[model samples]
Target: MTDTKTVLITGGSRGLGRNMALKIANKGLNVIITYHTNKAAADNVVAEIIKTGVNAKAFQLDTSNTASFDAFFTDVEAYLKSINKTHFDYLVNNAGTGIYVPFTETTEAQFDDMMNIHFKGVYFLTQKALNLMNDNGGIINISSGLARFTFPNSSAYASMKGAIETFTKYVAKELGARKINANVVAPGAIATEFGNGENKTNETKRGLVANVTALGRVGEAEDIGGIVAFLCTEDAKWINGQRIEASGGCML
Candidate 1:
């Protein structure tokens, strides 16, 4: 097999996902990114990655809908086969939307949305993706610092992240026999359009996040992509089943 590796990431159209795609491509890895709806944005990222002379493609995916996974993998497999690659090297489960509703006010539908997108989808997606991933490949799951610290109005969302963190450890243990590593990258408050631009547009919230962070500022998308990309590289092979919080020491 060719030594060049391929990494597939979900929600790679914009924000941190876009940054991760570019950085992973910087490591000379071919990239396959799944976008929920924004084909224009996904295409833009693909264009950027291809400029480095590496292979890149974008496919539409509704990560919360488990029924769509079979078709998604079918398309992805066809693309990989066309490139003469039977298996991918990395799977980054990073696609999700945010909803900020207080605990008491959070409804069953809201809670289920969180579970479907953040926990259940990731669980089964990785389960199915495992068959197509090569031995010694790595799985990087995007979690949130909210899983560790407390925050109002985040009960539903954060609870699911907590589940994912636990799920990742089990995956690392079970997949160890295959030499496949699974880990979580929990990011702190980042200045992005995520969570309805919670930290990006809210100056008051931004100030609060900066005060608590040891780095004395809210994290940028750039600060995190390299961390995720590094985990996909050779140097990170020894790291497994750990939650690496790239939160700049928030709530310390």
Candidate 2:
């Protein structure tokens, strides 16, 4: 079996997840990334990681569908066997989408979607992953700046992230006996394709975010990846059950 550490990242086909996968791979960790759809894009990411001289693979997953998880893990187990490994060393719960409907206009379906994807999905996915995670492994749960500060149309999204933040602490506490660390990374408005690329393409929105951020700019995917990679390293071994906000001091 291979002795190198490996990480499993959800929604790693593009955006921040993709950046995390690449950065972690650069740190000499093998990567297993999940894509909801777009196998071509996922393959491209795997290829890019391979270029870094690290083993990488892409698997399909719908993070919102809990029923598919058991079957998905079977696939993961088979892949792990092929790699001569029994478990991965880190799990990054980064798969999710943004919903921008105003609180007054948000419907039950929107709320359910947010809850399923952001909170429920992450909770159960991590629960199931524990079987495949080695002792001393770490989990990084992706959250958002809106959880800490209000955003007019982000009520549902932000609330779900808040739930994730709290849930992460419990995970850390409960899993401490296993030496598993669970932490959350709350990123600010990053310039990615999330929410239809509003922060990246909408000039007015970009300016508004920049004005509120102490760094005077919107965050980029690159800005958050290395932090996640760092958390999986030995240097961050003692940082457990904490919410690390990577927002460039937004709304401060």
In candidate 1, list every pair of residues with a backbone clash.
none
- Runs in model 2 deviating more than 4 A are none
Against the correct fold, how does model 1 do in TM-score? 0.99
Q: List the residue pairs that clash in candidate 2.
A: none
Question: Model 1: runs farther than 4 Å from truth?
Answer: none
Residue-level lDDT of model 1, residues 14-81, one tens digit each, is: 99999999999999999999999899999999999999878999999999999999999999999999
lDDT of 1: 0.94
**Each model's C-alpha lDDT?**
0.94, 0.94
Clashes of 2: 0
